[model samples]
Target: MGLLWGLIIGGLAGWIAGNLTRGGGFGLLGNIIVGLVGGFLGGVLFRLLGLAATGMIGSLVMSVIGAVLLIFIVGKIKGRR
Candidate 1:
């Protein structure tokens, strides 16, 4: 159940982040991967900032933010190469 929700949320988060930042989607699996990683990254960043997510929506928000940041960073890195 938890894993299922995580995947669903992750997919949604990634899709949202991708659309928001790049104006496109990463497909289903790619979105899930990005979103899971983004959620972890977001949690770490929130902790560092003394912030916390309280519920599913909060988690989604955090994931989206992290995904966007992740995408941006990756884009920059790729651009530099």
Candidate 2:
């Protein structure tokens, strides 16, 4: 199912983003949440930048980029709080 694939890719993207950002993961649920949101964000960002992601690998890369940006924003916000 498409939802299943989304979850899988999102989880993977989140995991990769976590590792890239903090040298670790955010657990299964965390990763999924982060990944899903990241996917959405990435889609918007890429489109705005005149980019279109296709296929599994493309989707994953976009998600990771968005996730990394999300994490960075969150960190900055948290730090300010």
Candidate 3:
């Protein structure tokens, strides 16, 4: 199912993004949330930039990029609090 695949890809992308940015993951739930939101953000960003990504790997790349950006922004905001 599409939902199942989305979760799987999102989780992986989130985990990868966390690891890449902070050297670790944000647990299962956090990763899923981050990844799913990141996927949406990535899609929008790509669309705005007139970019396209096809297939699993491409999706993963976009998701990870978005996840990393999201995490960074959140970290900055939290740090200011």
Candidate 4:
């Protein structure tokens, strides 16, 4: 159940992040991967800042923010190589 929610939220967050940042997404599987990782990153970041989010919407917001940051960073790294 948790895993299912994670995947759904992650996919949505990744898609949103990709569209917001780069004007597109990295396909279904890619989005899922990016989003899941981004969710983890977001949790860590929010904790560091003493921030908290509640419910599905809040989780989605945090995940999207993190996914965007992750995508941006990855883009920069790839551009340099």
Put down candidate 3 lDDT per residue, 1-81, tens digits, no spaces: 989988999999999999999999999988988999998889888999999989988898889988998998999999998
Candidate 1, 71: how far from true, in Å?
Answer: 0.3
Worst 10 residues of 2 by lDDT: 32-41
- For model 2, the stretches where C-alpha displacement exceeds 4 angstroms are none
Q: Estimate the Cα RMSD of every predicted model relative to the unseen true structure.
A: 0.5, 0.5, 0.8, 0.8
Error of 2 at 64 (Å): 0.5
Winner on lDDT between 1 and 3 is 1
TM-score of 2: 0.98
Tens-digit lDDT track for model 4 on 50-77?
Answer: 9998899989998998898899899899
Pick the lDDT winner.
Answer: 2
User: Candidate 2's residue-wise lDDT over 1-81, tens digit each?
Assistant: 999999999999999999999999999999999999999999999999999999999999999999999999999999998
Q: How many pairs in model 4 have backbone atoms within 3 A of each other, for residues 3 or more apart or on separate chains, i.e. clashes?
A: 0
TM-score of each: 0.97, 0.98, 0.94, 0.94
Off by over 4 Å in 3: none
Question: Which lDDT values do the candidates have, in the order given?
Answer: 0.94, 0.96, 0.92, 0.91
Better of 1 and 4 by TM-score: 1
Better of 2 and 4 by TM-score: 2
